[model samples]
Target chain A: MFDIVIVGGGGAALVAAIEAATLGKSVLVLSKHYPTQSQTSMAQGGINAALYPPDSCDSHIQDTLKAGVGLAKEAIVQEVCRAAPKAIEWLDSIGMPFSRKGEAIAQRRLGGATYPRACYAQDYTGLKLLHTLYDNAVKLGVALRSRTFLLNIIEEDGVCKGVSVLDMARGKVEQILAKAVILATGGYAKMYGALSTNGFGSFGEGVAAAMRAGAKLSDLEFVQFHPTALKKSSILISEAARGAGARLIDQEGQEIGGELWTRDRLSRAIFEAMEEGREIFLDMRHLGKEFIEKNLPQERKLALLYEGVDPLKEPVPIRPVAHYTMGGIDVDENMQSSIQGLYAVGECTNAKLHGANRLGGNSLLELVVLGKKAAQSAAQMEQAPQQKLFERTKIDTNFIKAVFALPNQIDFWERQEFLSKIMYHNCGIVREEMRLKGVLSVVRQHQKELAFMGVRDKSPLMNKELINFLEYGNMVELAEAVLVGAIQRTESRGAHFRADYPQRDDKKFLAHTMIWKENGVLCADFKPV
Target chain B: MKIKIKRFHPHFEPPSIDMEYEVDNAPTLLDALLQIKRQKDRTLTFDYMCRSGVCGSCAVRVEGKEVLACQHIPKDGEYIEPLSVVDVIRDLSVRLEDALVTLGSSKAYPLDMQKVAMNEEDERLIERQSDCILCSGCLSSCPVYESNEAFLGPFALSRVWRYVADKREQAKKEHIDAVVQNGIWDCTLCGNCTQVCPQGIDPKNDIVMLQSKAVQFGYQNPNLGGFGSFGLEF
Candidate 1:
């Protein structure tokens, strides 16, 4: 058994593996695909660090709290913001190759920041950081098992016992026992499907598995919609482009200002405009070719490739797409979930850092700081002997077989597409009691239909259809939770805007929406911040 | 659009075959592939994550030219197949295990680097090299690695140069030594890797720079003979 098993291959998981290995613990990273091909690579903007003079951590913390709209935990916010500089230093020591201002790391202004505090490496910030972390993990001899899908977290008698995974390459289910397991499995914004700027695997399966293993999840209704994704394809044109002076314009060529506001506000503004039947475009033509080439090269490439519009020559059509989920498995300051020895970090966990909404550039920072923190905490815990296998395993196996044996009467793709459309329309950026209930009923219908779903390809080796079907199951489960949370939280705050209420009701709904399973039935409650 | 896909399964009959389908409303190769998998045959296996070009999971050869399936718009009757350089796991999903191993063996990351101040010029010098997405498109087009598996291909060599040119790195000599054998010298400078790189990283030029650095360190090309034209031994 390994000391720590990380169940994702993104920036958070790699950093955790490096930290655990540095602590001289046996660690293994299980990835559904190669480590580098993760959602973290899609984070093109920079990571936040208050390194520039006169921009203290206090300002950064205040900015973050303001962006979170009164729901961010002060303690966690302070811890993450205060640790930002040292985190950037650690990254630099490992050769992150950050874009440099003379003799120092370059800092840029991201939205929702009080200062130019984000240290970047051109526009490929996340990609470069992820590669550097992967390189360090390899150099430190971290064992990696790619093509392994996390089926469930093994919990016996309310204690963590590692995980059960499907060996995609070998086509079999196997259980791995670890002293501790960290879930760094990323966000679930892709539940919005074609309307989201997330990878295909961002289905929140890890969060679902953790919840099944008796973990509490929180604030799942707070999904941040980025203001400027390429309209044709939901591929994100990084906020760095706007930070570099790209303007948002309406179809009449009139500037719709608030280009540098926090993501929620800008997205709502654009959503309101689009509701009025106006098309929005990101105008970067004034930024000049040299500046675009040097700083925002990836933005230019994405705009040209995806939408067939060169930002240098013309305005690129854009819309607000679901970008980041601010809600996930609820964890304490130590990054431990409700289950013992079950830890979570990164976008997959709602550590109360980004309560209602996440500030720009903070996600990458959280991946490093909290990733290392979770690893250190897990390593220092006393080793627990292996417990007997739980009966839940047998039940889960039967369930899997039942799913495979069901008739293929309903096409999984069609159902998935229909679910995405309804979610985007009824449960997306704007929501109300009637529409949310409408979508929730549809989601419940889909859950009922899951019993009739099956894949035509019985051969399990690298079965993409099987994976899609399973992901659909997970998505349906999470969709119910999201709609329930959205329906329950009757006040408008941060990303969860309620058109019915139309105001932040801090009096009654200031607390977080907590969801968990009790006796195999989903339940929701409120936890005071 | 009509597209043909090369299908293979180790446990299936005949092992390999070409299947064609007419995909409507499919704009990109990835869309067409997914359409076929969803509507025509559920058994078609491939891999993709971020339909955006950032994640490198969707790289395959379309009409014998390596392109990211998500980014490349397909022409009518174009052929899609797995990358020729790697072992196919099933159909279009090539095994990246061997290529990742070559990357690990290169030791391309910064070694024994001190925390030092860096300027914009220094950072810009290595910026292009660091943009590599590790897509293996370079290895797919690399002529030298086609024959010699031991050769450290374009992806790893470019990463090696990324660190060697950085101002913060202190162990440049060690990095040079790491690439001297089967690494930089094995490259043919054929420029195929440069042509196929979607990110525009020029590994061929980076290999030439490594050669110059080696010459500065008083190391001769092992391919060169010891005897001079003047018969200096007399």
Candidate 2:
């Protein structure tokens, strides 16, 4: 029995684990994948922390709340903003090797920021931060469990207990008994077929588990689509493109808008433009080769040195992709979930700081600020005995056999291509009632077929097919949730734009749309953000 | 286009499967696989993502060596297979799960509040090496990885050495000690890793960086003494 059991090994879990360990608690950190192999590692931009002399906590707070579009919890925003500096300082202490300028630090501006306050260790800041926290957590004596899948949560008499996890390497399920549980399992971006900078595991399973355990979800309709993901790859073209003087142009070389326009507006414009056979391009030529080579060298080098298109010489094709989810499991100021002895942070919980849309770099800021908060709160809780254990039935060999025995002769490439096409065409950056409803029907029809499908590989180790099955299941479930939420919401705001309701009707839809699976059906509920 | 794939399993004698794919004007290797998976057959397995080459997902052997499926253009008739001497988890996807896991297991630099300031030269030493995407492209192209599964590989070493070389990080000595295993010492100083890296993060420089730090720490890989020269290209 452990004092604390953490699900998901993103920034939030590592921070919480380290904090709990520092508080002298015997803790365990379980990740579905390896700790650093998370969507957190895919974060190319910097963490937004108000550290520069020109930037202030107040300014950061205001920018965040404004970007959240009236639904952000003001108090929570203040709390996170004030605590953000400490988190950055802590990361620096952990040897993050942040990029600096002269005597002062320099920050590259991103979308929806009032000031240059992003603290970074070059482009892969999150990877660096994850490494730092993971190392610190190990030194402080947290049991780091990798490749462990959470089977289910165990509870008794309405109180939180331990969890059952499948240790993939051992090919067996092990139940971990803990006094408390922290779900830092990240977001549901993988639900969308096309993802910009999202990992294969960002399926929001932790949030799903929370909902299954009766925790209320908030702002489920608030999904943030990044405005500039490469079309074929969905690799995020950082918003720093706009910040660094790149222009969004139509195929005919006309400007879309002031490139610095907010994310929501940019996404809508691009979506509409793509409808008119006007593919979008990020024009970095005007910025000169020096700027491209100096600051944004990766994009340029990848274009010229690798992909064979010099962005300085020509326009690179681009589009919007599902990036972040502003909505998730409802957590309070201390990052405590509705359930006692449970906490969530980072992309897993709804602090409501990023209400409808998240500003660039704030996602990183939230990880540190809310992550520290959850950890600090967990430490203060009176240490209690390990909770009741759930009875573990033997692994269903027949079911496993059936799951592994499905025909691997089916063409997954066509199947996935069809799924992605429908998803991208119907429920993409722009959506309508007719299209979303059609998408729901299509998903319902295909879910069973997908379940029965088998992948070619049966290797006992790193079985990509089995992993894809699980991932596809997650994708289906998350897509269903999104459609339900999108269909239910009558008005458009932030990333959830509806062609049916072209305006933001705050009077009717000020509250958040929360959806949960009840008896195999999606049930919608409302919660104040 | 006719393609031959080398196939081997512990359960069966090693053999090569000859497959055919239709090419439509400048098809990528990924396109050929897509055609094979869709039109021809579906038993063949491979790893891929962000099909346009950014994610470093679809890596496989084109002829005798490794290349990214998404980026490498297919020849009219080519022999392709899983990477050489690695545990092929199905077809193209090797058991790279260990690479990420092993790196995670090695401890990172401890937290220190006071930063060690450095000039531009110190910053430039590591700034370019820090952009690794964990694609394992470098590992796939590595000649040494053929025999030793425990080799830290180019990605991890580059990353580990990135921290070791950073002037801002105070625990350079500790970092040096942590990465000495099949970690920094096993690097052959081959430029193959650098050539294959899609992100242009030369693991060769990073390996050199690690060697310099290892010299500073008075430690050496017994086979290759500290600060020894390997005439590496680029």
Best candidate, lDDT-wise?
A: 1
Candidate 1 per-residue C-alpha lDDT over B1-234 given as tens digits, one digit per residue, 9 for 90 to 100: 788899999988999999988998766788888888878898888888888777789999988888999888888999999988799989898889898887678888778878888888888888889887888988998878899988899999999899899888989888888888898777878998888888888999999999889888877776664566767652
DockQ each candidate and list the results: 0.74, 0.23
Candidate number of the best TM-score: 1
Model 2 residue runs over 4 Å out of place are: A131-145, A164-174, A195-199, A301-308, A377-402, A405-420, A447-461, B2-90, B95-113, B118-120, B133-161, B171-234
Q: Please give me the DockQ of candidate 1 compared with the native complex.
A: 0.74
State the lDDT at A51 in candidate 1. 86
lDDT by residue (A1-529, candidate 1, tens digit) is 7889999999999999999999999999999989999999888889998987799999999999988887899998999999999999999999898988888888999998888989888888888999999889978879998998888988877788888888887677778888999999988888989999998989988998998887999999999999889998888988888998999999899988675888888888898999999999999999999999888877787787778799999999999989999999999888999998999999999988888888889999999999999999889766764665656555666666666688988887899989898888777788999999998898889888887778898886788788888888889999999999999999889899889988898888889899999877999999887
lDDT value, residue B229 of candidate 1: 71
lDDT of 2 by residue, A325-400 (tens): 8888888787777777777888978888888888878888888777767877776656564544355313322334
Would you list the C-alpha lDDT of every candidate in the order shown?
0.88, 0.71
DockQ of 2: 0.23
Candidate 2 lDDT over B26-100, as tens digits, reads 347876776665565544667664454444556787776567776677887788877655566555656555555
Which portions of model 1 show Cα errors greater than 4 Å? A387-390, B226-234
Top candidate on DockQ is 1
